[model samples]
Target: MTRNSLAARALPPAVLVQIPATSKANAHIDPGSGSFFVQMSLVGLLYAGVAIKPYWRRTKAFLTGRRSTPEADDESSDS
Candidate 1:
């Protein structure tokens, strides 16, 4: 017999398995999870922007060789 025929004969038939309805794992995220992810992403982005604003201003000042406005400086002085 040829190698191709021998290889085909060695493999068993494939069967499909069905899962029960009581499974915990989901194939797709529900709307609740989707909305939670969107809200978390927006909150994270807002905090990141707030956290990076100073660094962004400092980098801008360094590259331009000019100080930023006194509003940012005033905030630092209050601390």
Candidate 2:
């Protein structure tokens, strides 16, 4: 067998055993953190999409040599 396959075979059992062994360890995270991170991630994604949209369209048009239509901003209409 190859080195990667042998190594992969070796690591999974250690990972599996270590997790349950640490289950009773004291760890605290505020419940708000999960929701805050979720909201921030969603907002960041939306903001990124909004920010990148024009650049994406411009790059697509440039690479594909297609002119964007004035009436239809995106490819939502039936051609």
Candidate 3:
């Protein structure tokens, strides 16, 4: 058999892609819904964590040896 024929046999069959559900024009938003509240809470927490990550990293660096502490003057005064 040829190399091209061997390579073609090794490949798997093509898969069918599934389409997701689309929102209809008549969809309504209920304020007392549980799913909406859960989704909003998760999104809010995700955004908050992403926004504060840089500040958290800076604070962690100060706690570790990676960055200098602002209390250096206090330590010097104590000694």
Measured by TM-score, the strongest candidate is 1
The sequence of per-residue lDDT tens digits that candidate 1 reaches over residues 1-79 is: 2343233234422211122347566548565878856765654444444445566777888899998774662232111
Give me candidate 1's TM-score against the actual structure. Answer: 0.44
Best by lDDT: 1
lDDT tens per residue, model 3, 29-73: 655568856765654444444444445656777788586344431
Per-residue error (Å), model 2, residue 76: 11
Q: After superposition, how far is residue 9 of candidate 2 from its true place, in Å?
A: 49
Ranking by lDDT: 1, 2, 3
Backbone clashes in model 2, listed as residue pairs: none
How much lDDT does candidate 3 score?
0.43
**List of clashing residue pairs for candidate 1:** none
Q: If scored against the real structure, what TM-score would every candidate get?
A: 0.44, 0.43, 0.41
Candidate 3 wrongly placed segments (more than 4 Å)? 1-32, 67-79
- How close to the true structure is residue 74 of candidate 3, measured as C-alpha lDDT? 17
**How far out, in Å, is residue 30 in model 2?**
12
Candidate 2 regions with alpha-carbon error over 4 angstroms: 1-32, 70-79
What's the CA RMSD for each of the models? 22.8, 15.8, 20.5
